[model samples]
Target chain A: MSMRDRLRTMGLGAFGLLLVIVSWEVIGRNQLLGRTFPALSDVLATIVDPARRGLFQRALEATIGSALRGFVFGSIIGFAMAALGVIFPPLRAGLDRLAAVMHAVPLIALGPFLIVTLSREGTPTAIATLAVVFNVFVATSAGLRVGNPLHHDVLTVLGAGSWERFRRLELPGALPFIADGLKLAAPAAVIGAILGEWFGAPRGIGIVIVSSLQNYQIDLLWSAALLGAMLSLVAFGAFSVLERWVVGRFR
Target chain B: MLSPGAELSSESDKSADGSTDPSIEHDDISISTSPVLPHVDASEIGPANLSLSGVTKRFPLGRNDTVLALDDISLDIAPGEFVALLGPSGCGKSTVLRLLCGLEEPTGGDVRIRGCHPSELVADHRLGVAFQDHALLPWATVADNVALPFKVAGQPVDNDRVRSLLELVGIAEFAKARPKQLSGGMRQRVSIARALALRPEVLLLDEPFGALDAVTRRRMNLELQDIWSTDQITTVLVTHSVEEAVFLADRVVVMTGRPGRIQTIRTPGFERPRSPELLRSPEFHELVDELTIALDEEPA
Candidate 1:
């Protein structure tokens, strides 16, 4: 893409964001939602408040750590399972069904089970991992199978063995799909972590929101929810960058 | 089946391919040939014989549907001889190349390279092929792409060989550039360079320049002819373009579409290291027109 086009896209994105913030301030200040909802400015101020800095920091740190751990674990397992399906075609349908089945099981339902089987702190990461696994597996398996026939023919005529074919063709060809999955899984991982935290985790955005709401600390609740949104947004942004790079390289 | 080590050059090889092109289907499949190698009329045969004896390929299209892409095709490509498979689209010219490269199995008969199966040649990295689609790995640089067969064969990266091939194909300057960075013609050149990197016993080209523009295609044809002349490897080229077939091959084997059978096997009497002048020559045009007409007609 040209420099002018890229700048235009960024300018449009910034304008859209500004419009949302203006709407939020206008709605909240005018008592549109009965003052229960805080303005975007108020939420931002609460996040950076000196008195509550440490509280926000600890919550951000814990949540970020859990989400990162889950993302890593989920991505690896998902990629491996997809590769397994590609190498062994017989297992493809079964693996696909397994991913679909896992997705069908609600995260909220699994929360109680996870908390019972594992600790509260571990539960968040586990749930986050499950969310990422499904996205990554589906994308990876589909990616591995795609853009292959011609390349497969090239590799085959080059005398590549099954291992070499997987290594040289299938793996690289599937990278863009894996990256896409990772991008989609990022927000999901954060959501999973927050959901898991709702089941009595020690210190996280989920915990802060739940406690603040119960104690009637409206600003704190809004601040914590906004922080969670930012965290998910940041992860999503990072993965989008990765996805762009991979697609450029692989395709 | 004709063994791979059989005579690479047989004057009778032409007759073995027969006057009736497999591209055109007649009611009679009464083609005559031994199950083994063609009866050599000439004593001075070449070094390597890449022969397909009565090779038939039937692709199963879903449960009960099966497409017979090749039907009892027989052709012997002698060592250092360049033969082009000229036919209409879907005439199974690609299938013949695929069979020789061991990408597809003949549902009947055999495809042999050097007294062994095509797979053996491929496994040993002694077979080179370039398809119409320049399947250069998108991630790899031109140099790295050219060096792939070496890496695949479990050999150390022959950077020198890769460089020379890139130079040979006139893309040495773009060695560090990835495939997507190059133009269509340039990518095809890189693919061709990569194919020649190994200097295999037999080279199979399935319309390597098919994707290029007309001008680029002509230029590439001249360049390929020059390359092939130097290497003198046994080769089978699959192309629908009569001009390309006439320009590049010792013999053009035209086939009919749909259950592909040879339509005509005509030898273009062009000398080695042929020039652009020959392309404009009356003889070349005559041969091209003849093949084009042969390609246009279907068997009764």
Candidate 2:
């Protein structure tokens, strides 16, 4: 399809979102949900008023900083673990069992334990980062193992060394899958950051959101949630653009 | 057609005639020998072009048994000659090409190229190969694909040479295009250009045109013959088509099915610089008929 056609399709989705927002505003203003749901206009006004006055800036900065740090640390650990697992059979089996157990453990359950054990300062963001790392590690390693047989044969005939084959073929072949995993993990990272703030944090969108809810300032709470959603969407969009750039270069 | 002894004596006489005029005498000796050695010269340059001594290839089957792909085969291909390995599907014709190209090792015996082993030449970047599938990297443009050998060998690419080779194969216009955008015939042409990029002394082709339509195949065969004649590179082609073998090859080496062996080495009687019209000639039909009968004789 042409570029213009693709843009138009995306534009239609935006238009549908506008309709949902208008409906939500009309229903909430009429007290359809008895003040539980805030009017969309009130949420927008709260966002604009504080954002214009820069009151939410520090909270926004704190949330973004913690999320970025957690994402970076988690991704690095995940990659290292995956490489170790792939290189050693015993390690792979051990990691497989460990990963299964880890996956089964609820993120919420681990939050308090991690706060007590890892942080004297009680930084719950660490727990969220750990959750994201394990998920990404599994996805990337599985993708790497799915190399094409025909492409492998071609490399073999060329007498390519193991490292050369991986660099030239396997890595590029696994990129699409790795991108999928990263996309899935991105929102999880943001959520983990927010969850950590929810349990215990001096500042962040999650803290503001909780306070707003406790005070019955439903519009402010909704605005904070909206900001978090936008943050996740932005991260996903950035990775999507990266995927396109990489695939385009190869093609 | 003369006896093998006469052909042998003629080669010896041609050597005595003059070492400077080796090319002409070689063609004469080949044509004079039973119409089986079309234009091949058995004269030595420095070493034999390709030699397989009692080569055997086997694949491990399930538990205790093994399937013999090639069995105790001995063959020689001189430099600057066109040889076609014609056979049925399971005949291991491609196996022979792979062995010659150093893509696979023999289970027993030896494979030598220009008096050195296939492995030795492969390391030195002297081997060039083309397969039935035209394994061009989809990501690379036509020009980049043709320059792969140079890149892999750490040699600087000669842009002029790449262009010339592309022109030789008649795909110069598609240099900037991706493999996915090109037609099947055009892609094969790009592959041929890539194979010739290194100017390899020995070219190994495993049914390079098997995927093409009959008309395209015939056209490619003529183009290949012209290239072979002009370049004088030793070419070993594996093909199932009898007409292709008879049309382009100086010597057609027919192989039998399971545990493939050389059934016969027939020299086609057609003249040099073969054209499409030669396909309709009586002599061409006779050669095809002979090969067809030989193929039919193998037990089902």
Model 2 reaches what TM-score against the true structure? 0.80
Model 2: what is its DockQ?
Answer: 0.26
TM-score of each: 0.88, 0.80
Docking class of 2: acceptable
Second chain of candidate 2: TM-score? 0.86
Output per-candidate TM-scores for chain A, rounded to 2 decimals. Answer: 0.96, 0.88
DockQ winner among the candidates? 1
Q: Write the per-residue lDDT of candidate 1 for residues B107-172, one digit (tens) a residue.
A: 999888766788877777777888898989999988999999988888898888898888888988
State how far residue A239 of model 1 sits from its true place (Å).
Answer: 2.0
Tens digit of lDDT per residue, candidate 2, span B8-84? 34533433343422234345434222222334343322122787888999999999999999988877666666789
